[model samples]
Target chain A: MWRRRQDPDRAAPEAALGAILAAVLAILALIGPAPAWAAETAAAKEPAGAAPAEPMHVIVGYLGQEEVPRQPLSFLEPELQDEGVQGARLGIADTNTTGRFLNQRFDLVEAVIPRNTDPAVAIAAQMQALADKGVRLLVADLPAERLVQALDQPAAGGMLVLNARAPDDNLRNEACRPNLLHTIPSRRMLADALAQYLVWKRWTRWMLVAGRYPEDLAYAEALRRAARKFGAKIVEQKSWTFEEGNRRADSGHTTVQSLVPTMTQGADHDVLVVADERDIFGEYLPFRTAEPRLVAGTQGLVPTNWSRVHEQWGATQLHSRFEKLAGRWMTPRDHAAWVAVRAVGEAATRTRSADPEQLSRFITGPDFTLAAFKGQALSFRPWDGQLRQPVLLAGPRMLVSVSPQDGFLHRVTTLDTLGDDQSDSRCTRQ
Target chain B: MGRMRAGLAVALGVLTILPGGGAAAYSVYVSNERSNTVAVVDPETLTVSKTIPVGRRPRGITFSHDYKHLYVCVGDDDRVDVIDTASGTVVDSLPSGPDPELFVLHPQKPVLYIANEDDNMVTVVDTQTRRVLGEIQVGVEPEGMGISPDGTVLVNTSETTNMAHFIDTTSLQITDNVLVDSRPRVAQFTPDGRHVWVSSEIGGTVSVIDMQTRQVVHKIGFEVRGVPKEAIQAVGIELTADGSTAFVALGPSNRVAEVDQKTYAVRRYHLVGQRVWNLALSPDGKRLYTTNGVSNDVSVIDVAAGKVIKSLPVGDSPWGVAVKP
Candidate 1:
């Protein structure tokens, strides 16, 4: 049997000693010229005083909508219940854990709009309400345009807004806001990560297939830029016009098997790269491609922020903890939201300040670094406030690789090799 | 200087008296995290002497105060496996709370402080009775454990919390918390007890905190030419007896940075195996052993030579290393 220490009285003397030392240092500072170390020691001892100060309150608003529509794919792709919110919830829990030690308190005010409602009006109203409630740190899970609208709202003025869902390149470029920090990796970054890996493997020739959606075209455009940057060749390109039918129907498999081969028939390339951000037809081309080639991009071997199969760098513990909490594997949105909130926790703990402006300054300063279970410390690019992280190349069941591959060099960091660097930045904000 | 000389003299006397102890006969015990085994390597021959099987996911290893038993944190088993050094077999086990990752023993007392990573607590156990004494609530995901030279303070670095919690030994309560860079993985007290060096694996820097003020006086970062900044992740730290030179294992970069303690400057980078996680210095302070996780090898570094002398193949994903005193 273990004897547990139940008496809190044992801590009283230590606290009392701390208080006395603080008082002595305070007196020494007031009386005569004290050494620099004395002032520093006094500041360090403030947290140990007998009477614990009131915990500094930091309220963050989770602004988003529930039940967003998904692509009509396999029945195995279940509707996500707590996609972005659960990540913020876990982030709050993580923040509270560190907050407890720092005499700080973190609270999340959720303002989720209904799926059927007008998102812009509902989001604006929620932002106003959150501002009324003194919520200054906001995690926006809205689309790129709606996120921009929310950022432009007067209620969001002076607030630090973290974009957790939007991965639009314009968010980190020409339309980037001074107060908004982007946690999601842009399409360009994802494309570059995949391109680097493919180039490293010498799979330089690509047969590009794109879905007939604006998002899909944008992703294809990014991939095209990456191919040009990394010296890869796009041997052929084609757009898919076939509408996705009921994926679970009996004839669905046969239809996909016949349609994909016809769509990929004219291409002779090393790899078949599909750009289908909506997941409409990318999964169909993997095993049914014409040339029996390796498939990559938005489906087959995809680039993502977080994967259920990633269990390296102590991510196994995080994965298991999330499973225990949410009863499911963590998604990329969850990881982004978690990173956003954890950034707040880290800044507050380091600066020992709860002021929103001070926190924002500290977060953007050179000292800010966040550990998001990615094996490396992640920091925001000062120019665009985009979190720089390694993109994971994952297959269906395993992590294929992490890119910014071995030889991809950058003056700042290898991570810069993935995203927009200082030289390429359209963001004018310092 | 006199105290250090006396300590060296005592170490020499122990080496002469102990059966397995000698200047050139020290053994290095490395825990292979993924393989669930401990590889025992002889320093003189630079070869693995024996492979001892242990529980699942064994990490963070150290020797008992009397040097009679080796304590290994079998993380998946949620207990500490005590191995008798003479037989190189498990003799007993201690209740080390849930998900024990790393631990430290009080220099003069029989108390063992174990960092329970998942439970967010440090379990203190009595080695003589194999019974837990008390549990101290700490930051989340605590991994690193370091004790002051006098055993008055115990430092535990929480991975996710990113702070080093300093616990008073007598009160068993947190006395101070120093925020380091992100994902602090290991902490070590300088031999002179003036500072505590903490390595932040994700932040890619080592924070040297002043012991008296409990403040980070210097944040030492590495810059290996041609190696990306993110790859220079400082994880394991080993300080010399004189506290003049420090060696830091840069994870994933496959290099160990030798730093000057006083100036906090990296003097040289020695190429090692992939993903070097932990390091151990010999009792005589002549050789350093590094456990490289990805390459599955132990890099033997000659301290005076400031370079890797040899790489000995070990089990898969070798993580923590402990040297026989």
Candidate 2:
């Protein structure tokens, strides 16, 4: 079932827009020589003067392209069926809360493409259908390549799509699209955030351990770039191969305990950075390291856009709200989707318009900022359309630190130093 | 017991005034969020006279009409602990809705309006009867309660909703809603009740709304020379009684901005301890006390000189401050 609900009782007040005095006069004139209770009931039923304003409807579509469900190594983590869409639903609810007072209502239309289908064709069809329904705002929870294909669709040309899933660097760098704005932080941004924290703590030497997956290699490359940008040195590097075994079966720790330490034995470094983006061996490398070095990068002490351990700067308020709605802790993807939908809502509220062009222009232009419990105002970067925000460095049970650390300065904002700055960006969008 | 505590406080005040010391006319109470205690400080001695333990995660604090009881919003416990001001101890608990963050007492009545952040509603309670009056549905994360000087209109700013809701006190109905910047933390009315200044923390701006029209008339922004714009978050706002000057606490910027009320210009920035959260001014309007959240201390300011005179250490993470005159 869809999460959209229409409240019939939320009619716009007749006395809105400085018409209280006129409404009072009209009420008195309508119920002349009537009993007080009758007068009160008549006034409560409907104002006697002006017709009530019709609430404006702003509809946003959510397009989720199917992918293979990821299986976690441990049983504690399960595959989430509705990660991004739940966040969009919460976003709609939050926006409707504010929209009720402004005589505006928000609705979210969700559609998911089945797995093993031609994603390009599915994306185009979804876009055409959504556009036919007058949904000019969309949240795309697709891969980097499919996202580009979706934007290239004729129907999507007139729509504004917020990228809530993919975080590939090239999508933001050389292959940027004009209609796409990213809410998820890029891999390079996460690497830079972690590197800054490690460098600030004087942990300059790192042992880079990468996985065989393409995403893992991409993340490893980002870590290398971050090390070069900051002052950290990669003392050694290793590539891990898949070992077929049930990680949660009986006596599973014995296998991982021996393999991880042997794999980490040859490095002389202050920290071990794992590039296992998939639910792989990264979670097993923390306490099983040869040296007692802290594990970071994709697991252990990791840099993330959102975490359950974060509670400062009114984060508990958002965490509780999301938990109440979704019945689970808010994930990074959920937060990404939430911010994407909220960005559209915030733009509509501030600009007081439902037109996609005007809202998109205001969002990309100067003077547009959104606050999503990050302790700072977030805005889209001019060059790449990447969001500028602080990344949380979190352990499993506690928030260790926040990046864009102290002493890291920039000409404009310290947040710009984490992601690709405009000067070094290769994006052609203006 | 009340007379005994007052006598002891007077005797200690006399002892503290032996060496060119002027006895303070008020006592300062600060809620420590991390320590779950309220630190009571003597303004004259510039030291904590006593520390009273309360419920977990004490944040918003206020006083009763007669100043006989102090109410602390124990957020984690979902209740308000009432501290007997005379004894400097918690005496009772008021049944509040879920996660009450901030609240305001009616100026001339026994009604207390509490913002239930978790429930997205405002819980109205009669302090004298200790009974629930009504619950008004509000925006998301309702915070920053402010009442007009005449006590006819109440303004509650919801942080996530990004709107300042104006409620009619008599009918308990929302009259008007004014959209503001993001994460509005505090709302303070002018002395003459002509305007309400709402501080938006993440938006880093203060919006001044005309009370009559319920529209934003002017917006005030803050900028520190070396500090980044994101760090200059506006949280607590204190306006002078004469309505000429306003002091705003800049969270994490470690500075308090002094604004010219008439022109809406930031005149100067006063550097204080780390993460200055909430502020309270003395009754005579001469001294200002700031609760530094990160530094676990309170910075005392000389309003005339516009400089920090002293910083007295307190419990961990002092959140809200109130002065009893």
Candidate 3:
């Protein structure tokens, strides 16, 4: 019913505070008795169906793989087998909570490919099978290559795929696909979120340390781009060549304590920025930096899609609900998957349709916004199909801040300042 | 000009400190979520006259029907702290369900309808007997409680469920469930009880639902220049007694929108403080008070003047506001 209007004219600036405390003594003189709670009355209860109707079933397919789990650097941070799927499950529950009133029932059909198999072949067969089940909506938790292969299937051309796992920037840029929408925050977005906060805090000099993996290098490249974009200077860059050890071993701290300071000794920088996406050495960089410099990016203070410590914007309730359902803290992948499933739910609820075409159009349309517990309404970019949302800069046990920071303004939404902007985007698809 | 403004401030300050002999004096209570305290603001002086210490994470606040006791939702403590208005201290506590967020009172009865965020149910408590009458199951994360003017129909909105549920008072049954936008924070019924305006914090729109038909008649959107649409989140809504004008708190945009009630059009925006979370109107409806979460302050707006008069610093993370005459 509401329509967008032309932007209102700007108003005058704010005025100053002039009033002072006049009478401090007059505040505490009054006293009154509390009310007596004596009267009691019984009320009868009757159960009635709020909305009684035959529910329409909407099926959503989840395509993922049972990947060989990698042990995390810390014992507290365990690699979850049901990470992405748990979130999708929670999303289905949440969707059905709203869908019940609308007479729309949502069912998630999960097909996780077995380990040590050809992912493309498995994805193709799974896509065909899901398509046969009349499941047009899909939440893909696959990696970049597998996700692309899954969507490249002939049957997937009609299916709307929500990419929930891949954080690779290429998927949101040169390799962007019209049918595939990404809910995961790209590497560039994560880097830019941290960069904005660092620049806002006036920590402009960065000591960049990266691992040898391709994902690490890609994240490091994004950090470099963010530094250039946000007016920060990368004072020095280093490659970590140390082999990982048993994370829970008692001797691990001594080695980390010695090697980290040695690797970070002589950089005249304000912060040590780590790009160890494989979780090799980033967690050890903090408190062991050469000059008491703050460590961020991938560890210490991390720019992430979601964190366990984030409780703002009514996220505490969400976090509580997820913990009750998943029995673990939600990771970034879980949050993305949840948003992906919830986006479908939101689109379905708004459009009142289960048709994949209608839901996809409504989701990518200008008016479609997902309230994903981020204090902002998140929506996908028309140019790149990337979800634009505020990235949380989180410490290990608490949320530090969220970016785009206060003054980083954008022509469109401020969330566009984090990732590939319209002008910087390489994707031509709308 | 600076000297003249100082002189006027001193004169206004002196006038407020004196006891009101004939004219009615009102006290504005602001719940500081982070501070776990309530700021007792003097409406006349536009200053925090007293600070009442309460339980942890106090959020939703309101006065009893007789305006003698103030009920503050202490979420961490899982109870409602009752503050004696005259003494400015917490004197008693009520057994509210776990993580009580927001609540409402029946117009002509000593009954409290509380939104228990953790339980996904509305806990109905008898105010006079301090006993929970019943718990009505609603959608997930139930908040935004509203009772009709005639105190017959009760409405509760669930943040995640995105539905404003209409409940029958006598039978305690859900009569109708009207789906609105995402994260509906507050449901404010028009004084005449013809419609209910529900503010969706993440949806960035206020859904105006016709009470008779239980359908959304209109959706009101707000826009302010130099501010992003995400920041212009619709949160708390305050409608005038005559229902001619409605003021909506735009969260994180630091603005309050003046809207035309009949047309469902945003008239203009008055810049307030950062993350305006909720609103309260003075008894006379001539002034509006907004609790700004991030800034830890309260912005006072002169309703008829269409401008913010002052920003008074309060405790940390001011979440809710209530006014007592």
Candidate 4:
């Protein structure tokens, strides 16, 4: 230690300094092993982030190809299905580019089922093949029951099944499996988020329009639950069928008006919330509402995984990467698939190894977190497979606003208030 | 520079000034990179007192000029969180630029220079006001900044550009650009302020820059047969008072290389815990504290013998190390 003797109070070290040096060495020599009684677990120590190491492999398992045989009971048209699959492919490529730093490798593989055939068998076979190929993580964008049947294999213990397509609330809540994760927020979650936002905005009264389909009814039921939860009232309810389409011509506007009620119904609600999860007849209600009520569901105000018109703080980068890779923009389903893989990757980083049990625990742990394009950090629901995240509530042209505007005070953002939080959640058996 | 610990460890002197036995005197600080928690430990008793939680992603911690406050740059949280030495609580978060990764405090003033990795800027914050007094543009991902002994010149390490920007302290402008290895980080000056050793993680070596000449005098590579220079990924480097020896932590290889500062040669390559990222030597220069990132362990080495005496498990992805001993 040098003191240039420029300062008035400066002086050389006395004999006490020499004694300190001798004591310091003596302390270093008296070392001991760690007593393994830490306050926090090693895995949950850091904020959840994907590991820098590359994944073992990426397996994109399709159910089966149409070239095989006859078609299934229900599916979107071939062009629509192709569009969805195209969305998935682009998402895979986008993840690869974004995660290129970690040397994350990706592969897109597919299989198709025949007419009237059960998609479950083919999906299970593909999942088994995925296991053999050392892919312990998966992204399945299939329907509800079929996805469940596909993941029913006992050997699928190590594989993390991510539901990319299925939006059935049961998949995220009651029927949620150990390794099975859901990227698609449940319909209940979306409805709750929207209802919370509406309630916060003081749009308390609702003009409810229910659809004929089961999924539609389920969505309506979810909205009803939300209305009850958030002190909103459903003032009126209306149901319609796909009727008199060809009969109503341009010249017969009077006839169409007579059949569909041109005058005011007995509705005293502020918002006309349509619960048509399917694109059946609710598409016609937006511009056709008699009174000036806010149309939702199929049009106007809609809650989805991700929207194309979204151009927020970090959306452009994700959208650009997705388009450049797959040569097309990502769909809502594609975003779900991507989030699933990223979640698994983050779990691997936390646990430091690809043990399924450890990764599962790491994810469900209280500290498990993953940052998405939603501009906030989200964690998983320990009781269920649901990833409690902000639902992107949007309109046709632009995003009106994100929900959970009030009462949500996360370390990051208030949007986290939309989805199922720990207290109001019913997933106790997970 | 092990003996550099003897002179620059002003915090350890404060601890030794207390009336305590030999075993309970030294204080150990573990910088948890991800959790942003600094674990304070009593080295002799091996007892962790409290995990002082700070801002988001706290890394690169150092005591103040008078060794009163432990200044930690909370990276993602965009603040230089200050810890009150006596209470060890985060009393204040210094307003900083986005992603303040590493920092250097001026020895005589209240100015704290924070390296903003994202915006490629060096924000000079008035620590007392916790306000940004001045800012200057630097290269991409400015990871480290160092101040001269007299506090006249400031050297900023631009990680991507692999160069050190020497700034005139009073003017706060870049006066010189001294090019070093690829991914130059942790630009630390020698104890006597004669030379600056810039650690290049990917280059697998430390470049010694002569301050007076403002040029790299020599590039010292870690000598090993099977280990490539890239594998070394030398991150954090420290030196002794006489500038006789220096220790460089190789992140990829999980080892520390002790190099002869004058000869520009590695004296010994000591095996440490897994993925050693940073280091801190005891005040008496007898013990060395290392943050093993991957293994989440801290390797306490006997500096005189140059061997690991204890490997204490800390938090997940442990990174920075500061010793009060």
Highest TM-score among the candidates is held by which one? 2
Model 2 chain B — which ten-residue stretch has the worst lDDT?
Answer: B1-10
Higher TM-score: candidate 2 or 3?
2
DockQ, all models: 0.23, 0.23, 0.22, 0.02
Of the candidates numbered 1 and 4, which has the greater DockQ value?
A: 1
lDDT of each: 0.82, 0.83, 0.82, 0.65
Under CAPRI classification, how is model 3 graded? incorrect
lDDT of 2 at A216: 92
Q: Which has the better DockQ: candidate 1, or candidate 3?
A: 1
- What candidate 4 gets wrong by more than 4 Å, as runs, is A1-79, A82-116, A244-264, A349-358, A408-419, A423-429, B1-325
The model with the greater DockQ, 2 or 4, is 2
TM-score of chain B of 3: 0.93
10 residues in a row with least lDDT, candidate 3 chain A: A37-46
Error of 3 at A23 (Å): 69
lDDT tens digits, residue span B128-158, model 3? 8999999998988999999899999999999
Off by over 4 Å in 1: A1-46, A69-72, B1-24, B262-266
Lowest-sum lDDT 10-residue window in model 4 chain A: A14-23
Task: Give the TM-score comparing model 1 with the true structure, all chains together.
Answer: 0.89
Which lDDT tens digits does candidate 2 get at residues A8-95?
3322221111111222123123232222321221122111123558877788999886677777776777678888888899999999
lDDT of 1 by residue, B1-325 (tens): 1112222322211222323543344678999998999989976566888888888899989888777899999999999998898899988888899988999989999888999988789999998898888999988789899999999999999999888999999999898888877788899999888899999998888988888888888888787665656678989998887777888999988999989988888899889999999888877676678999999999887766776778999899999998875
